[model samples]
Target: MFCFLRKLHKMESTWPHSLQFLLFFSLLFSMAFSKSVIEPCNSSTSCNSLLSYLLPSDMKLAEISTKFNINPIELVGSNNLDQQTSQTLILSAKTTIKIPIQCPCINGIRQSVSTLYTVQPIDTIESICTGFGNLVSPDQIKAANDLDNSSSSLESGQSLKIPLPCTCFNNTDNGVTALYLSYVVREGDSLDSIAGAYGTTVTDLVGVNKLGSPSIDPGDILAIPISACSSANMNLYNDSLLVPNGGYALTAGNCIFCSCGPRNLSLHCVPSALSASCPNLQCKGNNLFIGDVEEELMGTGCNVTTCLYRGYVNHKVLSSLSNTYRAQCTSNHSNPLSPSLPPSSIGIPSVHVLPSLAPAAAAPFAGHGFGSGPTAVQIASSATVSTRTSNSAPFILVFLLALMLVFIPFDPNVYS
Candidate 1:
């Protein structure tokens, strides 16, 4: 002890004063932040089975679960510990316990390799599962960790296995035949919007999600059904199947609108009549012409919205009047569009005749007749307007040239 003390005193004397202070703080920091060593298993078998753990001082199952993201109840169940044992505020130091390894899922399938996690000070099963996009459920963690009760909390410095949600299918199940996607709900999201975005309906979403009610809370994970009941034709709108009972066709002047039927089984469409009073009618149905363009209809017995054709207007007349128009259709199925022939085309030029300026104006004689020509004053005014236009042409050209010079980049080196 005298020799050690003498060596320390010699080293302190040799070291700079600042270096001694830095060394003391560094040692203190290391001691303060030091952690216990928790070894992982070597193979899948060992990972699935119980591994040895050394309990740190004053740590409980609750702290272990939070720190490691393990279900505390599972920890107790794995060791066959009594429920009363978990209530103890502190566990003895150096207590040996067995920890189960949790296997994570990849693309909805479990991986062969198990992952080991150390319990953190603030870890919880819900938080951990949420980190994985809610792919892991609390029940899954409990079962994997062998937790007997859901109320058990975790202790810091405890080890846990995180079992991921994955399953192997034998290709015989109904779910294997169809493709599914997982969607996490966000704030202000309703079943209507979610279903509409995915080309599905609330009924279909409820059935797929196994939801007892239409209400869904934020952060709820949903499984979306994306598989087509029957192969959809690429030529159709939205790559959807056209059912004969509920199918839609483009008519020469009819405005077509389609919706994805329940469960995405078929595409249903309804047509509305054209009108001139409507705004922006010209832009609508520009690609379509006067003839029924039909595709092979598939699937049947689907509920479709029945639409009525109010009347048809001449395409040329409608285009000249407005750039767009809203095709009005009522959802009342009882007032369906008449399957009768559409009205005759009303050309713009043939609609009306302009009135003469004079009162009691007589109709102009179709046959040739002598009429007065332009007067001197009118001719002189025309000449003056023509001269002004001719004179302004050069100035307009010069102004355009100046604008070009301003906008176009000029390279002096290129001229050189």
Candidate 2:
């Protein structure tokens, strides 16, 4: 090793000073594309976030869970996947899934410190970002970890920071609590189609984005508002217990979980089947669990008593009972596991985008940046960011041409 180092030093010394400077300058030039779309959040408020990740290749359920450092159960629950999702179950490529995020403020910016993507032998930064559906960008990832620009692909087994796009916007859009999904635009995607699939309208998409045109292409990141049923339970934790449409979320310190179906889209708080034990959840008198409901035959209808989840406070599970008369319990009670979803798959398949039926947008500020929830509207109006666009291309291209003219070799990954 010593002999090799000496020889390497000899070779490096033979290189001209201009060559070394050119190489260093080229690396710096590449970082010009390293603009991050991170939301600058310095608040103490909790930011519940989600990333829309498209599978770059086939991988087992456990593999993805490990990749993002999320529990397999939580992963499945977030995407409304079937309970069959296990560690070894393999998912197909091109499948898009939602990864729940508890985004925290790091160094005055809010992002997920987890979700580390290990470098694979065949992996490149471009493939990592673009192939995974632009939940992250090569520039963002590179800047996040101060990665080398010597090559596009790093050594296999190298772990890198994946700065996924997320938002809080006070966790509300307009006036309601919502789950903000940072959706990346793919080929053949249109505002109308995306809106229809997610139950959002074009007006909301445009209003949230402040986009003058609906034209989008692959690699562009957009904030998608999914209708969520947040716990009206006001807690000392200040948690809204927001669950995205057609998905489930474990909350209240993992003691209780809530679901909001694709249809109905109502809050359904239940004792978690996956939890080993939980605090007392039965509502007194009604003798029902956190999510239980009982009905009695009445004259022309049914008398109903429900054990409702109010909120968690001071480490205590809060429950309340409510009585009402209903003509019917509705068809949703047919089965808890199976719910009527749209044409696409919900669990273990491509999850549908749940749209916002609320007011079309935020109090119009402005931004072309990627952010989540009501904060996205604020990010759009405030930040001076443009990452996955032609905005910085000409500068990079001109610099690259200058390097070529001077016969300086640079990594091809610089543009990403």
Candidate 3:
């Protein structure tokens, strides 16, 4: 019995030691297997924030996780990677790895306007109230605005505030001031002419005035606007040029016919406005938009004929820039009087004209001389600017990618 009990005690003690050894060895084996099982990220920068060393060919996910003091699952999630539950985890080796992130908007979202209305001219209580007869009356307008009973004679430049039909007036402050302008009616004014003068469409006038016929008569009090031409031309000149379209009027400036000092002379064919298209072509009755400028900038000092010709030539040059990309080519010589170029010869466009304006080119202003240098430079610079604008998108993307590479982190043990 003593020997058997002694043997039993020995067996029990050996069993405990065996269990301890099995547990310790199992843990060691598990760690070793883990070091060789997991794969590395495709890109070195992927999950680099959690990695302590660069990924090696032999190292695995478990080894990287231990070295970085991070969970293997966390590392995969951070890198936007898929975790493989199977024994074989093969990762793609690529120079770039795509991780979808919400891109920030470079341009703000656009919103639609709830209501849109245009400015009108010298709106009187009666005329404005007529548009919204149901909601307001002329009497009410005169009373609310403390106007005289004879509201028909409103000032030419005054803006009249009114409301649209069917729109609710939530409060007394709902009314807003709208633009009003002056328009002149000639003997042969048509609906189209009147609308063009006012910068409003026929449909808008018809809708507002509810007219039955398209015809307008002379001496009619039509609301129109003083064109930007008058303002722009005036600004360019130290003095103002307020000539009417197709009518001759004395403008306060140097004469187009004589180099004599500033005088009052009439100009024909919308003298206040500059030509928008090539000169020599008939004026299409559109006002020249000479925005607010000073008098000194107004005079090109050239005669009307030369200015018109140069205007047409300018149109031709602008059209070329609009149509073609940067390329080496020769152009035919253009007509001195028009934009039409001469026939091609010897594969090289012949050079013509002394870049300077001729003495009789136009009424030359004092101290005003034309140089071809700035004109040529402007043409080349314009072409370059257009080219850069066209290729800006691709350049932006490449720049962003370069920035990403520069900022991204890299660790040797990341993929190990």
* Strongest candidate by TM-score: 2
lDDT of 3 by residue, 55-126 (tens): 223334464344323445444332323333311443322111111111111112111111112225655454
Query: Backbone clashes in each candidate structure, one number apiece?
Result: 29, 12, 33
Candidate maximizing lDDT? 2
- Model 3: lDDT of residue 292: 10
Report the C-alpha lDDT of model 2 over 1-416, residue by residue, as the tens digit: 23432443355446654565565565545444432244566676666787777777776778777777877777877767655444445667666677887877777766676778778889877777655566666556777888764545588999888776676655566555567777776656778777766666677677666665666555566777666666664332445666777777666666666777655546776666444455766777645676666666665776777777777777777788777887865432422222222212222333432322221221111212223435435534543335553334556667655644444444345434
TM-score of 2: 0.65
Q: 264 in model 2: Cα distance from truth in Å?
A: 4.1
lDDT: the better of candidates 1 and 3: 1
For model 3, what is the error of residue 335's alpha carbon versus the real structure, in angstroms, after optimal superposition? 5.2
Compare candidates 2 and 3 on TM-score and give the better one. Answer: 2
Q: Between 1 and 2, whose lDDT is larger?
A: 2
lDDT of 3 at 109: 14
Question: Candidate 2, 86: how far from true, in Å?
Answer: 3.7
TM-score of each: 0.25, 0.65, 0.17
The models' CA-based lDDT, in order, is 0.37, 0.61, 0.26
Ranking by TM-score: 2, 1, 3
lDDT for 339 in candidate 3 is 28
